[model samples]
Target: MCVAAVSTVQPVLAQTASPAASADKVDQLIKLLDDPEIRALLNKQTAAPAAEADTSMSATEFSALGHRIRDHLRKIGEAIPQVSSEFMRAGGTIADDINGHGPLGVFGLFLTMVLIGLGAEWLFHRIASRSRMHAALAQTDGARQNPLHSAGRHLFAVLAPLVAFSLASLGLFMAMTWPPLLDAIMLPLLLGVIACRFVIRIARLVLIGPRTGKDVAATAGLVPIDRASAVFWYKRIFWFACVFFAGWALVGVMVALSIEPGVRATVGYALGLGMLLVAIETVWNRPAAIARPHGRGAMEWALTFYLCLLWGLWVAGLVIILWLGIYALILPGLLKATTAMARNAFGGTPDVPGSGNPVVEVLVERGARAIIITLAVLWLAFLINKRSSMFTGEAMTDRIIQGVLAGAIILLVADILWQIAKAVINRTLEHAQVSTADSAHAARNGRLLTLLPILRTMLAIVIALIAVMMVLSGLGVQVAPLIAGAGIFGVAIGFGSQTLVKDVISGVFYMMDDAFRVGEYIQSGSYKGTVESFSIRSVKLRHHRGPVFTVPFGTLGAIENMSRDWVIDKFTISVGYDTDINKVRKMVKGVGAALLEDEELGPLIIETLKMKGVEQFGDYGIDLSFAMMTKPGYQTTIRRRAYMMIREAFTQNGVVFASPTVQVAGGDSSSAAAAASTVKTAMDLKKLAESGEGA
Candidate 1:
C-alpha cells in the first residue's frame, strides 16, 4: 500500500510540475510508473480511489477581474445621481436666501444688474468714441507711420472694459445695501459678466487689427485677406460669436441661481440639439454663408468642413460647436499670450539671429501651445463627461487624462531638449565664425558648421523617435514588438543596399580622418572643385566654372588638396642670351622682396622668390626658373604679381625680352655671308629709291 501511494504521488507531482513535459522527462516518469513490481503493487492496492483534481484556475481569475470592473462602474454610476441631488439642494438653498419675498424679488434684482451692465457699456463706448486715439485706431490710417498707435489701440480695447467692469462692481457695492448672502450669490453673476466681456475684448483685439488695405498684419493676427468684403464678413461673424457667448454667460448665471443641476444639464443638452437644427437651416438657406467671399482655398475648405460636420453629425456636432466657441472666444487671447511669452523667454526682445532662430522659437511656442491646449482638452472632456456620461465612465476618463498628461510630458521634454541642442549649436557656430574670420582656420570652421547641421538633424530625429515611443507606451501600446520589428527592417535594408552602406561608412571614416574640410579646393579622381557642403554619403563640390558636383565617398580615390596650409609655385621666364644672368637674378629677387613688403601679400608670403639661374638654352632665349612659397589660395595672385613686376622692372632697365629668330648655318660660311649680303643690297636699293623720290 505504501509503495502504491508513493508511485501515485510521484506521477501526480510530475504531471503538475511539467504539463508540457519534454520527451526525456516523460519517458523517465513512464519508466518509473511502469516498473513491474510497482505496477503490480498499485493494481493490488486498488484503485484506491483517485483524488479529485481542480482545474480552470486561470479562467476563474479572469472572470473575477471582469466582475470587479463591472461592479466598480456600477458604483460610479450609482453615485452620480447623489452628486446631482447635492447640487440641486445647494441651488435651492441659494434661491431661498436671495428671494426676499418670492421669485419676483430675485427677478427684479437680475433686471437691475442687466440694466447697469448695459448702461455702463454704452457710456464707456460713447466716451471712447470721442478720443482721437480711438478714432485713429478705428480708421486704420497712419497706423504704419507710428507702430505705437496700433499698439495703443489694442491696449485700450482690452483695458477699457476691465476698467468699466471695475467701476460698476464698486458702485454695486456702495450704492445698495444688500444682505451678505444676496451679495455672495449676485457677486458671481457680476464676475461672470466681467469675464465674458474680457474674453470678447481680447478676442476682438487679436482677430481684428489695424487694416492694411484689405489685409491685416499684427503680432497675433489671422491670415491676410485680399478683398474688403471678406474682412467685413469675418469681423461680423466674429462679433456675432462674441455676442452669443456674452448672452450665454447671462443665461448660465440664471441657471445657476434658479435651476437644479439635473434640469440645468437637461436644458443645456436640449439647447445644443436646437442649435444643431438652426445651423442646418442656416447652411441650407445659404451655402456660401460660412465661406468667405474671396478667401484662400484653405479657408474655404475649413469653413465648408466646419459647417458640414456642425449640422451633419449628432454628438460630434455639439462638441464641435463647443470647440468652435472656445476657438473664437478664447484661443486668440491664448495665442497672443503665447507669442509674448516666447519673446519674453528669449529676453525682452530677440536679436537678429535669435529672432531668426525659428527652430528653437517655434519649438518653444508650439510646446507652450500644446500644453495649454492639452489642459483645455482635459477640462472640456471632464465637463462633457459630467453632463453626458458618454466617455464610458470615470475609470476611462482617468485613464484618458493620465495618458494625455504622460504624452504631453514626453513631447514637452523632447521639445525642450531639441531647443537646447539648437541653441548650443547656434552659439557654437557663431563663436567659430568670429574666431576664424579671415584666418587660415576658416576652412576648418566651415567644416565644423557643416557637421553641426548633421548633428542637429540626428538629434531631432532621435528626440522625435523617443517621444513617439513614450507616447505609444503611455497609451498602453506594446513597444517591444515595434522595436523588434524595426530591428528586422533595418537589417533587411542593410542587406538590400550594400552600396549605400558602403558609401555612408566611407564618408564617416573620411570625416573622422579629416582628409579635407569644407570650403577647401580638392581634387579626387577626375573631379576637382571647392567643397560646398557635405551630405550623408557624398560631398557637394562647386566648380570654378559654376557647376556643382556631387561625389560619393565610395568613388573617391587619391584626394589632392590644393588649398592646404601652404603652397609652392614655380614658373619660368625666358630672356635674351646676351642678358647678364646675375643682373636678371638680382632683378627677380628685388621683385620678390617688393611683393613681400606689400601690405596685402606680406603675411601670405612665407618665402620670397629665388632664381635658380638659367635652366636651359631654349630655341629663342635662356630659360630662367624661379620658385616662391605663399599661403594656400594666395599663390596664384602672388605669382601673377611677381610676373608683372619683373616684366616692368626689366623693361625699364633696357633688358630686352626673347624673340623668335631663325638663322641658316648648316652650309659653308661663304653661302651664309652671300645670303646676308643679298638681303642687305635689296634693303639699300629700296632706301636709295625712296631718297631720290624725296629729292
Candidate 2:
C-alpha cells in the first residue's frame, strides 16, 4: 500500500519541484517516504481525527488579549528611560561631526546659516519695502471703493515678504554641505522653523491684517471674527504649531538614532497628549466673543469627550477607528469653518447679496475643501494598506479602499460643481434686482427676478439627483435600475398628482410668456394683487389693501397686468349745463399745462390730463370726460393731484359743479308754490336723516 501511495504521489511532486531537481532526486525522496517507519508515522497522522478549528471566542483568547495589553503597557513604561539615551547618542554624533569639522559646532553652524538666510530675506524686504508700503496704502484707500482690488493688493503685500523669505532660506540650505547625521537632524529642524514662521505670518495676516497700528475692527483682515476671538485664535494657533513641529523634530532625531519603535511611539504619544491638552484648553477657554449655539455647555462637554475618546483610540493603536472618528466628526466642521471664514473674508457684508468676488471666494473655499478631503482620503488609504493584514486579503481590501476613495472624489467634484452653479445663479439673481424708475428696465428686471428663483430650484434638484447617482456609481453600485425605478416612480406620481404637474407646467409657460412679474399688479378672475414673489408652482400676490393671496399658476388664467408700461385713465365729471363750454375747455387745458409743469407728478405723466369731450348728457348736467396717460403704478396719484388742481381752478373761475335741482311750473301760482315747498321739505328731511346716520 505504501509503495502504491508513493508511486501515486511521486509524479505530482516531481511536476511541482524546481527544474534543477533531477529525476533521481525525486525517486530518492519517494523511496525514503516509502520506508516502513515513515509510512507508519504518516498512517498514524492520517488515522487521527484532525482537531476541530476553534472559531469562537474563548476565555483563553480573552486572557491572551489581556496579557498582550499588559505587555504593551510594560513596554511603554520601559521605553521612557530609553528616550534620554537615544538623545544622548544623537548629541554625541553631532559632537563628533563638530569636532571633525572645526570648533563651530553643528548647531552653531546651522544658526549661522539660518542668520545668513534671514539677512538675505531682510535685504529683499528692504528693497521691496517701498512697494509693499504703497500696496498697503492702496489697499487701505480702496478697501471699500473696490473690495476685490483691495483684496488682491493686500494678498500681494502679505505674500511677497514670505515668498522672499522661503526662497532665500531654501536656496541657502541647499547650497550648504553637512555630515549625514547632521543633515538629517538640522534639515528638518530648519525646514520646520521656516514652515512655522510662514504659518504664523499667514495667520497674522488673515486675523490682524496689515500692521498699521490700527485696531482689529479697523484692520482689513479677511476673517470677520471679533478682536478678542481673533487674538485668542491667533495665539492658540501659534502655540499649536510650535508643539506640533517640536514633536516632529524630536521624532526625526529619535529615528536618526535608531530608537526602538515602542520607545518612539511612547514619546510621540506623549507629545500628542500635550497637543491634545492644548486643544482642549483652547476649546474650553475660547473667547466668548465668538458665537456659540444654544446649550453651549453641553456642546462643549460633548466635544471634550469626543476629543478624549479620539486620544484614547490613538494611544490604543486603533488607527482605523481614530481616523473614522476624525473624518465623521472633525472633517465636516473643519470644512464648514474654512468655507465660512473664506466667505467672511471675501464677502463684504452678510446682508448684502453678491458682495464678494465670486471667483476668488469659490476658488479659495472649494479648493481648500478639496485639498483637505483629498489628503484625508489618501491618508486613510495609506493606513488601510499598512494594516491590510487585518482584513480578508490585500486585493479585496484594495478594491474596497479604491471604491470609497472614488466615491469621495466624486462627491467632492459634485460639491465643487454645485457650489459654482449656486454662485452663478445667486450672482445673476443679485444683478436682476434693479431699483430703477425706468419702466422698461424695471419690467425686465422684475421678470428676471421672478424666473431665476424657480430656475434655480429646478437646477438644484437636477444637480442633486445627478450627483447622487454619480456617487453611487463610484461606490460600485449599479445605477441603471435606480434610474429606471425613479422614472417609473415619477410616472406614477404624475398619474396620481396630475394637479401638481399641471401647476408646474403652467408656471413654466406663464414665465415663458412674460405675462406678469414681481412687483406688477395683475388680476385673473377674482385673484388680483401686486406680485410679491414666486415659488415653483405658486405666486405670492400682495393686495393693494393688506391681504395677501398665494395663487397657483394653473388657477391664474388670462392675467391682466395693470402695472405695465403705461395706463390711460379716464374719469367723468358732471358740470352745470349753463356753464360756458369753451370756457370749461380752456380751464381744463390750463389745468393740463399746470400738471405737466408740476415737479412731483411731471415725470409720471406721459400725457397730461385733458378733457377728451362731453361724455354724455346726464340727469342734471353734462358729463365731461378727462383722460391722462401716466407711468404704471403712478396713475392713481397723478389723477388725484389733477382732481385737486381742477377743483381749485374751477372755484376761482366761478364754475360750479352740477347738483340736483327741482323746478315746479304751473298756471296757478299758489299751486306751483305749494309743490316747490313740498319738494324742498322732502330734500331737507333726507339730508337730516343721512346726517343722523353718519353721526
Candidate 3:
C-alpha cells in the first residue's frame, strides 16, 4: 500500500536543523571567515596605501572564479540534511509505496488516520473531564439534555476516525508495500466516520427546539454563531479536506507507476489544486457571530452561495470549454460577485438610526476583505486545475495562492495567539486583586491593565508586519522598496507634526504618572471643574458654569484640587460668648444623629456630619467646622444639604448671627434705615407684598 503524499519538505523543514551539522557548520563558517585567504578577500582598508596598484581582475577571470565557487557551494549545500527531515523521510517510504499502487493503498491510510484521531480525542476529553466539566455536568438539572455537552461529544466522535484515516494513510505509505490493500480497508472506515458524523449532527439538531435553540443561538453576539452547527460543519470540512488529499495521493501512485514512461502527469497537479480549493472554501465557510444582525445572514448566505456556484460553474465550464473549444469568460462575473460579497461582509455598519452606538464597522470590513481574498484564491485554484498542455497557468497561480494562503493563515494564527495573550493579561490582572477586601479594590488591578491593551496592539502590529513580509517572500516579491517607502512616510509624518506628537507623548506620561484622575474637582487657571474625560493628548473638565473645558496636557501648569480625598467645609454661625460650648456641641451631635437616622440616603455618607469645636475664635462668637467623607461627586450636594439643615437647627437652638457692627458708635436708627434702603435700591431687587389696602 502507498502512503498518501506526505509533506514533501518535512525532511528538509525550513525551520529546523540537525545538532551535529548545526554546531559544526557554525564552527566551520567562523573558521573559514577568519582564514587568511577569506579574511583578505573580505577586508577593507579605511585608507589606501600610497603605492597601491590596480588589482582589479578581468571580467572573464572573475566570472570563471565565481562559477567555480558557486559549484563548490552547491555541492556542499546538497550534502546537508536536517534532523526532522531525516525522520520524515524515514516514514516517507510508506507514502512512496502506497503511491506505487491503487485504491487499496488509500484504504490502508484511512484506517491508520482514524485510530490516531480517536487516541487524540480520548486524551483531550480525559483532560477536560478531569478539570472542570465533570463537576459542571453533575450539577446541571438535565445533564443528558444539555446540548453543549452533547455537541462536545459529537465533535470528538466524528473527528477521531477522520484523523485516524489520514495518519493511517501516512503510515501505510511509509511502512506498507506499493499499491497494497489500502483502499479496500479505508473506504469502509471513511464511510464509517461519515456515518458517525451524520448521526451526531442529527442528534444535536434534535436537541435544538424552538425555545431552547433560541437561547443557545442568542448568545451569538458574545460567542460563535450556531455554536453546534459551526462545530459540526467545521469537522465536516476538515474530513472533506482529508478525503481530497487522499484522492490526490492515489493519483500520485498512478502517476508513479507510469513515471518511467511518457504518461502525461497533469492529474496529480490538478487534484492537488482541487485540495487547495476545498481548503480555502473550508476556511472561509466558518460561521461567525453576527453582532449586527442586519444583513448578516444574507452576507453569510451569499458567501456560501459564492463557494458552491464557483465550484460548480468551474467544473461545468471546464468540461464544456474543453469539449466546445471556448474559455466561456465567466471569470469577470465571478470576480464582480465576490468583490461585492467581500465589501458587504467586511464593510456593513449597524443599522442603528442614532448616533453614539458602539461602532463595529471596522471588524465587519476586516472580515469581509478576508473573505474576498479567500474567494479569489479558490478562483485561482480552479484556473490552475483546468490549465492544459497549452499555456498552463499552474506556476503563476500557485505563487499567488501561496501568498494569499500565507496571509490568511497569518491572520488566523495571530488571532488565536492574541486571544491567548489577552487571557494571560487578564489572569495577571485578577491575581493582583485576589486578596483585596473592598468591592472596588477587589476589581482594581495594577497599571498593567492599561498597558495590556497597548502591549497587545504593539504585538499584533509587529506580528502582522512579519506575516506580511513572509507572505511576500514566499511569493518571491521584493520587500525592500516597500520598507523604504514606509520609512520615508514615517519620517515625513514625524517631521510635520513634531509639536502635536510631543503633546501626545507628554500626555501619555501625564496619565502614567497619575497627575490627575476622573471625577476629581480641581481649579486650574481659567478652569474650575471636575474631570470628566482623559485621553492621550488632552483632558475634558466639566464646569459648574455649564461648559466643558478642554485642557491639553502640555498646557496644564498648575491645579488646585479641593476634592482629591476628603474635604472639610468650615461653618461658623456665631453665638454670644455666654453660650455653652458643651451645649452647642451637643446640639450639633444631635443634628448628626438625626442625619444618620435618615435611612433613605444614609449609605451615601461615610460618617455622619460632625462638629469640630472652634475652627477659629471669631470676633463675637466661636467658629466651628463640620465635615464628613461623602461619596465622590457628592461634595456640592452634601455641602448644600448640610448648610440648609444647619441653619434650621441653629434657629431651633437660638444660636445668634454674628454682626460686623461696632454696636456702631451708638444707635442711629433713622440713619441706619436710610443707609440700608439706599444699599437695597442701588444693588438688590426688592420684592414686597402689596399694602393690605389699609389706606
- Using TM-score as the measure, the top candidate is 2
Where model 2 places Cα greater than 4 Å from the true spot, the runs are 1-74, 84-106, 130-179, 210-221, 226-228, 280-285, 289-308, 323-341, 349-356, 388-409, 665-695
Q: Which ten residues in a row have the lowest lDDT in candidate 1?
A: 218-227
For candidate 2, the per-residue lDDT at 31 reads 100
- The global Cα lDDT (0 to 1) of model 1 is 0.67
TM-score of 3: 0.48
Total residue pair clashes for candidate 1: 0
Can you write out model 3's per-residue Cα lDDT over 1-695, one digit (the tens) per residue? 13433455666664477645678789999999889987776664523442243233233455654565465444434434332353345245445655554344555556566666556556654555554455445647664333334435445544544455435434444555434434333444555454544544443333231122235553221112345654555465456656654554444444333331112123333454565466446545544433454525666555456555544433333332332221233335334533443333333244732221112222333344445555654555555455532232356755775666566656655554554565455556446535553535432433344445456666767777987787787677889988999999989998998877877887778666755555567787887787776655677899978899998867776767765444554455666666777877787787777767767546556777777766766866666667767655565676677777777877888876565433324488887777777756644432332333333
lDDT of each: 0.67, 0.79, 0.54
lDDT (tens digit, per residue) of candidate 2 on 359-415: 667877898899999999999888888876444444645776788787787778877
Give model 1's TM-score versus the native structure.
0.60
lDDT for residue 329 in candidate 2, whole number 0-100: 82
What digit string (tens of lDDT, one per residue) describes model 1 on residues 1-695? 99999998998898889857589998998998989998988886764443311254334555754565466445545555665575566557666676534445655776677677667866887776657455657667643333344456656756675777557764665578886656655665566566656665555454454233333443333222234433453455455444545445535654555544444444444455554444444444333553546534564456456655543332222453456564664577566667664544432234354334445566666666777766776666555655443333356566665676578767867777787788778777776665443655776686786688778778989999999999988877889999999999999999999889999999888887778877788999889999888878898889989999999988987789988778999999988989998988888889988998999988889999989877999977999899998888888988888889999999988788887654767878888888788877877998999999999
